[model samples]
Target chain A: MSQELIDAITDMREEDAVAITKKLLDGGASPVAVLDACREAMGIIGMRFETGESFMPELILAGEILAQISAVVKPRMQQGGEDKKLGKIVLGTVQGDIHDIAKDIVGFMLDINGFEVTDLGVDVAPEKFVETVKSTGAKIVGLSGFLTLAFDPMKHTVEALKAAGLTDVKVMIGGGQIDENIRQYTGADAYGKDAMAAVAIAKSWA
Target chain B: MFIRPDNWNQMSPLERRQARLDSWQNAPTPPFVSPEAEKNYRERISRVRKIYDMAPHDRPVADLFMGANEYIVRRKGFVGKDVIYNHAALREPTLEFHREFQPDVSVGAMPYPGKPWDMLDFKTYIWGGQKLPDNLAIQAVEGEYMLASEYKEFAADPTAFWMKKYLPRAYGALGPMAMLPDFPRISESVDTIDLLVPFGLPPFQEMLKKMMEAGNELMRILGEVGQTGAMVVSEGFPGMGFNIVKTPFDYLGDTLRGTKGILMDMYRHPKDLLAATEAYVPVLVNSIVGASDRTNAPCAMYVLHKGADGFMSQAQFEKFYWPTWKQVMLALYEEGITCYLFIEGSYNTRLEYLAEMPEKSLVCHFDKSDMKRVKELLSDKFIIAGNVAASLMSTGTTDQVRAACAELVELFDGKSYIMTHGCYFENTTDDKIRAFIDSVRK
Candidate 1:
């Protein structure tokens, strides 16, 4: 049954995925089992994306399917104490950049891969990232931007984290134009070319 | 000038393309400031033509992909808003940049006329000084202007879709356009009364007034700018971009369906998405051909978005993105207009499909694609330009910029290539741009 759920989600049968999730929950399958199936399906989709068998639309649609499944399963699951999330990470699209699609993808990947992501959303100031890190005790920080204008802000964000005495925080930068040179210029700890890379970086840091 | 023969429709695509190219080359030369200027202009045009013809030429022509926007800012200390709001202020600086840089092609004074946009309450883009800092470039705000279920209606009548659905959603002040009657439904005289009713309404009247006011403001800005292409041409530089056309896929993704919305449409309504994009081919073809004819510059710029490597798989791109866009390009090629495609993102996986375009039909300006691979696959077939990282231009040292430029020129061996930055020169420094242009000149 779980394999069936995974296949349905991986195949991008949106309505079928939702229906199968409900069916599993009703057929004495645990909510945790349903959630596990979702993670497995996402891993398959992410692998396909990395292999070029899939693209952004597949990732996006898979994320949407996961969200729908989570909505169906969240109420049936127990409350809070059994938490086994990998680690905490704060993410944003950096200052002066309003692009959120890539950032949101990174956030979704991190969430599915077991990290607790605090998405600060677009146009986030450096201080906001610093304060979020300080308050949440997240050692991982992801700064996203799709423009060259985001370069200075990324450097500033990295500097701001250090200035706030959060020097041990791991900063990863990615977007449309970012690469190794930009990683060095921004003083980020690492550069991720895509959302899966972001998840891997966060996992390694965690 | 080569007029279309009566048998134009009966001719093969290649024959029609040659006729159009002949028309373009035979168009009368613009008035020049001096004989020396005319001589320089002819030399530049000849060099470009040689590269396009896949023949040996003087040297690799160097042109700015998005023009000298950042150079003007750095040299003149003008903020982004100043460039948009003060149109006349750019004439001297633009001319000065052209004189100093001396690129083979000139993209002169790309002014946005913020006043008109502001007057119209344009919702599509947030320009400098409006929402962002005065120094930053304009950024588009994505929205789902066309809903997923509306694709059938859109494909049925794209003009009505624009007037009744798209325009009102794109322009905040044009909300009354939603009340417009479908013109195709009102063929008879008796049906004319209903069509006229919406125009009589106060809201529709108010929208028309606002549109006229915005139009007038745009005209005023244009008057100040004063035919930038002609002005530049008189000084010995031929212009490259006559007009702009978006790929049908991009027309859907960028304007109507937002990126997320379109991606979903690919799954939920693949047939509708394909139909809608196909519907846009004739619209785009006619618009670009008309613009090219009017400007007498036989080139149209297509900044491709939503069809890059990571955006979709090669199969999806072939199915939904490339076919209709190829139709548009082929239609333009028949009309004698060349397509200048600035392949905005990395097109590593999509290069083979691009190479499938008709020889001499395109000039691919790449951004992040691996140029070595691009040269191997595309250099023999098309006029390829670019892959200088915009990050390197903005943040790297002058020496670094020079090294990157030298590397690309050496790779292309100075043949069938145009030296240019990978993307727009926004946020780049004056010294780096100088290094970029001067490195090639040497």
Candidate 2:
């Protein structure tokens, strides 16, 4: 069963996902086995990278390969359940600004750790974010705005969320324009300078 | 030049005499500037300064960095210019991709030339419509700052109609306006945070704590894997700044109405392209300063193309960009950081304007500056970094890259140089990247 799980992560094959599922149903493998392999493979690639043995081009391709592999293996590995019903997340970039490279990095890292992120693409309207959070019953909302001009809309989105009666929800802010001072100015519960920081905040959020 | 391979140090009296005489024969003399011509140049600078007063450069706090120099300059460096330029040509509006080769997106370092250490992601895009001839070049520099590599081909990243984007300003010729509100201003506090990182933050303090922890663990294992073929380069520019874009002109792309276009538009509606830069200047510089300082590497370099002099003549650069640059330098310097500006191309036409820059105002990364003259003139003040041409990597064999690297290493010996290509290597083939590293690592 362990060998089978390792094979799936190595190949990043969709067929591996189906087989892993079959094994789970057959009571032959554990979710821990699958997750361990998934994380181990990612660790291998990342280690190769930090040493200058690798550069960005390879990291990107490898990241994609890992993502594809994880998608196939995730559902089965989560083994019919998630760890903490750790409330839902609605994330998107603010309006009039369409930069999300940083946002996407945050999203990927969040997903890696464990967060059900509803990522709205660039130039997202504030109202849509509020509506999505309300409808999905998600308690966490993340907004990203890259421009100072877009700060207005970010503020509007938070106000809209409060107006929509989701006041108790945690609101996290990030991107180039968001900082500890800016977060306070924008009235966000949490803020991070980059994706790695954002994921950590998400992990800590109540 | 002939050399005594065996007895390189041995020299007879006659041979030494001959060598001394030969050196005297080829010794370069300072180029003479006639009194009248020198006067005319000084007058020209005086006139320009009258038109646009030189920006004040305060006693900016400066930091000096010893070279994190690892690779032998006589050894090879990446072939950035060839790959980047070649790929850029492929994406040119009228030009066709050089058929025998296509732009490569993946780059890897192997234990050996034949082995793959791992591949990393390096993304690139071309800005469609460039506003200036050097817009793409500036963008390439910025990429080097942010992402830490200049693999972007010329004209990649912000290309097409995107380059011509001209935003309507609130007013016209309104000398420097107040900074745009809501924009982030750089703070020197980032330096404290950086220095404090090693002390170990509360895992809850910042997410980087966790990432750094993880990275530390990863580095340990990578150390083992690295025992075989070895990495391309052993060290990294931890606090290095990669300039991704040039200035605001390029920021607008083709957005600006030409002088004629603006003149015609002035009559049509007016508020179309007036002075919008005052607000953006601070915001952009703030981002540059903040991002660069955040990295905590005191030796940060910004990629700028106007040649060694500047895109606009000294007067115009001072009138428009210099104040902003000064602001950034001050903010960064306050954090005890030093900066290098990769000044590309020739500034010969406007050398006098750039000549009087304050003592070590900022390091001048020389390109077209007459090396001998600039070496003599600015060597004392600036942290000179490069002048090694990229062709040496592309056309010159590995040995050539080594020789060029050696020359740059030796010539700029005992000084700081962020050894790199004349430009970027967006289209550099795998073979060249391999050879370049092998020859230079020695």
Candidate 3:
């Protein structure tokens, strides 16, 4: 039954996945099994996206499917005491950059991967990052920037977080045309090429 | 009409270039214009000829490019005001500004009265939460104006679908557009103006009034600046000539589908995209060919917004981007027009695809590609324009600006190279801008 559910998601049969998830939950099947199956399917989808076999729509559609399954499974997991929150993460596009697509994607990926994600939307100032970190005690913060001009603000945000005694917080930057050079320039702990890498970094730090 | 070779990618770059040159060489000449227009055409041609005839070393720096709008707005002291609506007021200040700057080419104003999309309210609608409408010229707002699922509708009848379906979804002001019932076609004997009257209810009239007011202001501005033409010419400033022919893929991606949607379409609906792109070929050819005739300019400007690095993989670019764009360039080139492509982002890997153009037929103005590599690949085949780092102008010291400009000038050997910012500067001080401009003057 678990393998069948995973196969439905992996094949991107939305109706079948939803129906199977409903059937398993109603029949008193373990929520952890459903959750694991969905995670496996997401991993497959992310790999396909990375390899160019799948693109954004498929990624987005798969995310939607996962959201539906999570809705059914998350409640049951809590009842079963199987809800082990991965870690909390704070994500935002830095000040001076209003591009939010990448940040949103990273937030979505982290949320589905068992992390509690606080997404401060686009053009978030440094103070906001520090405040969110203080309030949430999230160990992972991801700075997003699509424009080269956003480098200064990203640097500022990272510095402010450190200066605010959030020294243990790991800062990761990602967006268009970024590399290790940009990561260093922004004083980030690390940088990811895509959202999956961001999820990996957050998981390691958290 | 463009026919792609079966082994387009297999053919060598040199062979592609040769093929394009051969096609252009054999294409029919343009038809004659009216005698008066012909005389004007000849005079304009003479002006361009005189500039081209000058030693590359002697050509003025200002002649090569126009200043970005942000720099001008800031410099002219209209930085915080409602500048878009008051564009006509810019005439006297602009004239004064030009006198001081003495630019070799006039940065032409946006079309007066403008279209519906140019209105401030429409801009506010599409991009919300603005103290003022953002400077779209500098910042890219990725709008998924059309979804991937709507490809069939868009491909079937683009005009009807956009007017009825996409416009309403894309902008708030156009929401009433969704109320427009489908027309099953009736007698043309009835007055069309009266038919449109019902459609002009409420907010429609307000928007119409705004458009008219904008149009009137444009005329006034033109009247104010109309006499400056002789002054501009006599002072050795030739008017800049630029006609736009948007590539179909960019049209779909930037304005309609958005970046993510179009990228997904490359994998999900490649054939539909190819069909839609092909459908656009004749529409573009007709519009641009007519514009070329009206402008009578030998050059056209095409700003390439997508197809840059990380936007798509190289394989996706070859399949979805290059074919239509290449056809457009070749078609325009056949009509004796040169293409000035403003490559908006890093196009390092995509340069080889562009190299297929006939030599001297393309002026590739790059924004962010590595200059050294771009020079190595394109200098022999194309006019390489750009890219002085905007950071140097806006933040760096005068010495830094001078050093960068001098290095680029030296690198290009002072020929077929236009010293320019990689893209529009966000903001720069006057002295620093002058320093960079002075460095390139030699």
Candidate 4:
């Protein structure tokens, strides 16, 4: 199981849906088995990160590798609907900025840590976030952005959520270019300073 | 349009003094290196520019730059109020692990800011370079550093000039002093660190820790290295890092989005970028300058080739660079900190821009820039530092090191400047460093 996981990590060319499915089938890994392996390997990568043994580039690369492997194992996991729901969270980068380094990490972190994360990707305007929250009734909204201009849309998104009567849903944010003053000003429920903290905070909030 | 308070001239004396105190209290600080060990730290760092006496009066400037640390020392009145510490940048610090360490010296521009210095440092890293996939600002160009000085000059601008004329003008309204939401500053610094460490799980904690240790030794060496130029804002600390950082525009130029993102947005929406930059300048500058009380700005751009002046072909730099630098610097000048920039890489491409930078601005260090010309254009008003290339330390003999120092000495023609390397020092023979210092001081 470990060897397969390592192979998947090393062989990262298979992105998108097809490669993920093919690889999982080829490795004869079940959904539960795949999740365990990915969790274990990602934990190692996380340790490396905590010890300063890793940089952003490496952490990103590992996450990309895990994502590809997960794509391969998704179908098998569906066969076992008995797994814990762990709650659901919707994530996206704020509007007007398309950078995704922080968003990607947040998504990967939530996934690896057993959260049902619905990542909406980058440059997502506030309307999309409100719509996602309403449609999914997600209790946690994780927003990310690289530009300070995002502060407005973020505030508007929260306000929109309140307007939509989803005030109880916790809202969190993280990114490289964000600062503390933004959190206090934005009125975000919490600020996840980085990817790991984003996951930890998300879980705690959930 | 934040017009001046209409009640000007009607202020009580106490309110006026408090305003002065608040402004003074919020100044940013530069990096710290132990001045006692300046000589040694000088060898590790590439160059030292002594343009102006940073200690304007008899007051030690370094102490003023590391403002918070000194504030801590002074508020405690550990030594006594009248007892001015002679160059106290490298104060003793105790880390999470019960270890008390006296970090090496640092050189900064701020003297006594109230908070920690991360706001200035992280913001610079994000916006200092030329590599964002998109320029995010209307003024962004393909290549060059982002020193937002013009942000300091926004009060004079009109409303249209502010909203319609700036790039990322919205940011101009946000910062340490901004009445905007708290998401910007707080989310970027420790909040990001707090998240990345646990959530993102970075891999460089140990390396960063070691780098931090190594970074200190470098400070110690520069601490006592006999300075020849007037200390500008770098009161006593040297950490403002001889002021250079890789242009992020360079990041985009080489990446997939290339110039399509913010670069296009700049030419397509030039007026907006300019206006936004104008509005953002003061708050950003205040946040930047007041973030730390350093003697100079914190920067380092030529790290890839270690302050390469001759390394990059001119055409490659011009085509893939130049324009972004012009915009970022123009913005920095709009703020008042343009006077504190020190160009680390090739100045050949933009000598005029370098010259046109705020008067007393250019601190030409670690490049093959024309020695006589830099002197002719800037030395009187600007603070030129060093052209002592690191190659001299390793590749040359002792006599050669002496000769290089002599040549640099002669080139400035006895104008004020600091004697040091063209790049960072590594695997260096202590003797070589000794010889370079020995020759220059004489």
Candidate 5:
């Protein structure tokens, strides 16, 4: 049944995946077990995306399927399933950049990979990142931006984190035009080219 | 009838294209400031025409893609909104940039009239001054203006879809356009009279009034911009990008369905999406060709989005993106217009497909693609330009910028390539831009 659920989600069988999740819950499956299947399916999809066997459509559809399944299983898990996340990370698209699609993908990947992600959403200011990190106590930060204008804000965010005395926080930057040079310029700890890279970076920090 | 020759219908596509090229070459010269400026214009146009024909030129051409906002902010200490709201504010910065840089082409400072946009209550784009006064560029706000289920209706008749559905969604004041009758069904006199009934209503009357006001504002802005364009040309900088075209896939992805919506539609409604994109090809071709004729310029700039490597798989791009886009290019090619495609993202994997474009029909300006790989694959087939990274220009030192430019110039050996920045110089400093042009022109 677990294998069936993973296959359905990975294959983009949206209705079937939802139906199977409900069936498993009704048939005495644990919510943690259902979520474990979802994570497994996302891993498969993420691997396909990395290998170019699948692209954004599959990832998006998989994310949608996972959302639907999570909605179905959340109520059941409310009673007893207290699954431990790997770590906490705060994420956002840097200031002056309103692009959110890539940031959302990175957030989804981190969530599925067992990290608690606090997505600060688009056009995030440096002060906001510091405020969120202080509030959430997240040790990992992902600054996303799709324009060159985001470079200065990214540098400011990295500096803001340090100025707030969160010097040990790991900062990862990625987006349309970001690269190794930008990573150095912005003082980010690492640069990720895609969402899966973001996951690997977070896992390493964790 | 004015632009086309009397034998246009009888001429073959190749001959018709030659005639159009001749017309472009023989276009009446703009009023030059002096004999020196006239000589410079003639020399620059000759160099550009030779490059387009893939012939040897006296030297390689160097062009800059920049906006007036960059100059205004850096030199005059003004924000984006200042120039966007006041059209004449762009004139000084625009002329000064060209006077200083003296690039092979004029700076593309197309005016984004903010007053008209404000009047229309435009929902599709967030202009510079409207929301974030400090924003450097206009940012498009993506949403599913056309829903998934509307693909069939869109494909059946795009014009009708635009009038009754898309216009209402894209512009807040144009909501009354949804009440418009299906235009094709109104053939008879009675039906035509029925169409006038909606115009009598207060809501429709209000919409028309707003549209007329917007039109008047736009005309006023254009007049100011036209004077600037004339000044730039009179100083001997010839313009390259006279009109713009969008790939059908990008048109669908950008304007109708948002990025997320279109990507999802690849799985949910592949056939409908394909039909819709196919329906857009002729529409795009007609619009581009008409614009080219009106401007008397042979070039149509294509800022391609959503067809890059990471956006979709090679198979998906081959199936959904390239076919309709290539058809539009081919149609424009037959009309003797050159398509200058700014491949805005990494297209390393998609080089083979681009190499299949008709020779001399395209100038592929790349942003992030590997230039070495691009040279290896596409140099023999097309006139390639570009790709000094925007980050390097903005963040790197002047020496670093010079090194990057020298590397590209040496790589191409000064043949069949135009030296340019990968993208526009929105955030780049003046010294770095001067270094970039100096390195190439030297």
Candidate 6:
């Protein structure tokens, strides 16, 4: 039954997954089992995305279906005292760059993977980053930008974090043009090529 | 510093160009006003012409490979925020920067509607922090502008479907267009103008006035900036502002059917997707040919988006992408204009298909493709431009930039190659720019 649920999610049968997830839970199937199946399906989706067998729409759909499935299962899990928080992380598109789709994708991926994400949205300032870190206690900071001009703001944000004595916070940058060269230029601790890499970076920091 | 010719300020742009063209065509006694400057200009032109013709003249020729944009504006010490939002303000500073660079070829900016900030959709326009920073390219936030069921309607009458079904859904301002009643016979009679009395009403009048003002502003900006481009050429730089076309699949995928929506359509409505793609071919061909003829430009720029290696499978590309794009290029070639294919992402697997193109008919400017493999395959048949590491130009030292350019020149030497960036980038230093030109020279 759980395998069927996994297949439905991985195959992008959104309606089927939603219906099947409800049926399984109502039939007294484990909420934890249903959630596990969803996570397993996300792994397959992420791998396919990385392999180029899938594209943006598939990733987005998977995120949506999972969110729907999570909505149904989260209450059950909470009632049973089964929720596990991975870690808190703050994510945002850096200043001067309004591109947030990539950042949104990364955030969605992290949330499903059991991270407590505080999304700062797009065009976040350095002060905002520092403040968010202070408030949320998010140890992992994911800064996103898709333009070349994003390098300086990224660098400044990193410098600001260090200046505010948040040097222990792990800062990672991701976007269209980001690479090791940009990572070094921006003073980021590391950089990711895609959402999966962002998840991996957060996990490694944790 | 560039010294303007006599009465330069007095001459209109056309007269100035005609005078310069006359001088170039005639090659009067002494070649130029100053002997040394004449020799230098002649040498540069000769070198560029040799590369353009693929003749046995120069070993490696470097033409300037950038557009005048906020990148150059910021490099010239102006804040991008202040100038990029105002089209009229962009003219002088960008032109002055171009005068300073004085590249072998002047590649001018294509006029997009409104100011840079104003061109974007409202949500992204604000969320993206209004002043466009250098590295950012304009992207529409992904959404389904057309639903899956709308494909049949779209295929039935694309124009009406776009106006009635798509435009309202995509843009908030055009939301009222959805309420417009169909006028099947409005154009059939001259009395329809009088029948359409509501169009002259207050609300409609205000909207019409706003549109007219916007249109007038766009024209003024185009004229002023386009004049700057002509002036660049008049000052002895061969101008290149080729018209770029998107493949129909990309067009549908990008603008109408959102990426996810299109991907769904690919599975659910494969035939509709194919039909829409086929329908777009003539539209693309006509636009390319029409623009080329109108502008008298030699090359048309065909930017291949969403057809990259990983974007779709080889089979999907062969079916959905290559056929129409191939048709567009062949059709353009038939019209005496070759296309410069700015291959945006890795196209390694698709090179075999592209190689089937008519020899010397396309220039491939690679961005993410493996440069060595590209040379091994297509360098013999096509005029290859680049895959220069833009990240290096922005971050690496001049020596690193020179070393990379030297490597590319070595592979592409005299083989109809113009050393250029694989793609445009931000924060590239003047020294690195010089290194690219110098490496090609030496």
Local distance difference test, per candidate?
A: 0.84, 0.43, 0.67, 0.46, 0.83, 0.71
Residue A192, candidate 4: C-alpha displacement in angstroms: 1.8
The alpha-carbon lDDT assigned to residue B196 of candidate 3 equals 75
* Model 3 C-alpha RMSD to native: 7.9
lDDT of 1 at B238: 70
Extract clashing residue pairs from model 3. Answer: B113-B215
- Order of models, best TM-score first: 5, 1, 6, 3, 4, 2
The Cα error of candidate 3 at residue B354, in Å, is 1.0
- Second chain TM-score per prediction? 0.93, 0.41, 0.74, 0.42, 0.95, 0.80
For candidate 5, give the DockQ: 0.66
lDDT of 6 by residue, B1-442 (tens): 1123678667754343334333333332222334544455566656654554455766665554542244565576645443433445656765665567655565544344534224323332332124444334344566667777777787766767877777656544444455454667466667577447647676556545555666676677777776665555445555433666777888788778766667656555789888888877787788776776565455678777678765566767887778877887787666556678887756887888888987667778887678788788887877788776666777878998898889988887658787777555657777877787678764
lDDT of 3 by residue, A1-206 (tens): 48888888877677799999999889888787788788788777777666766545556667667888888777667554545788888899887677776677778778767899899998899999999999998898989887655777888998998899888999999876455656766689999978878988887887
- The sequence of per-residue lDDT tens digits that candidate 3 reaches over residues B69-169 is 44655566654232334455555565564556655455434433322345423431222123323432324467777777777777777776777777666
The superposed Cα distance between candidate 2 and the true structure at residue B95, in angstroms, equals 40
DockQ of 3: 0.17
Looking only at chain B, model 2 earns a TM-score of 0.41
Candidate 5 - CAPRI tier?
Answer: medium
Which of the numbered candidates is closest to the native, going by highest DockQ? Answer: 1
Q: Write the per-residue lDDT of candidate 1 for residues B1-442, one digit (tens) a residue.
A: 2467699879876666566655665567668888988898888877777776678986787776464555564467777777768777777777787787776777554668899888888898887889988877688898999989899999988888998899888888989999988777898879989889999999999999998999999998888776665677888887554477799999899999999999988899999999999898888887787777676665688888999988988788889999998888888777767788888879998888888887878888899899999999988878898888888877788999899988988999855988877766566676777777776665
Query: Could you tell me which 10 consecutive residues in candidate 6 chain A have the lowest summed lDDT?
Result: A75-84
Which segments of model 2 are wrong by more than 4 Å? Answer: A1-32, A40-62, A70-85, B1-442
Compare candidates 3 and 5 on DockQ and give the better one.
Answer: 5
Ranked by TM-score, the better of candidates 4 and 5 is 5
Candidate 3 docks at the CAPRI level of: incorrect
What local lDDT does model 6 show for residue B319? 79
lDDT tens readout by residue for model 2, A1-206: 35565555444443564466456646755656666665565555344433334322233333455565556566656445555545578889887555664576556556655678889887688889987887888788888865444556777888888888888888888864344545655677888755556766776874
Q: Report the lDDT tens digits of candidate 5 across residue range A1-206.
A: 39999999888888999999999999999888898888888888888888889877888878888888889998777675556989999999998889999999999889888899999999899999999999998999999998777888999999999999999899999988788878889899999999989999999999
Q: Which stretches of candidate 6 lie over 4 Å from their true place?
A: A50-52, A74-80, A83-86, A111-114, B1-68, B81-100, B107-144, B163-205, B260-271, B315-320
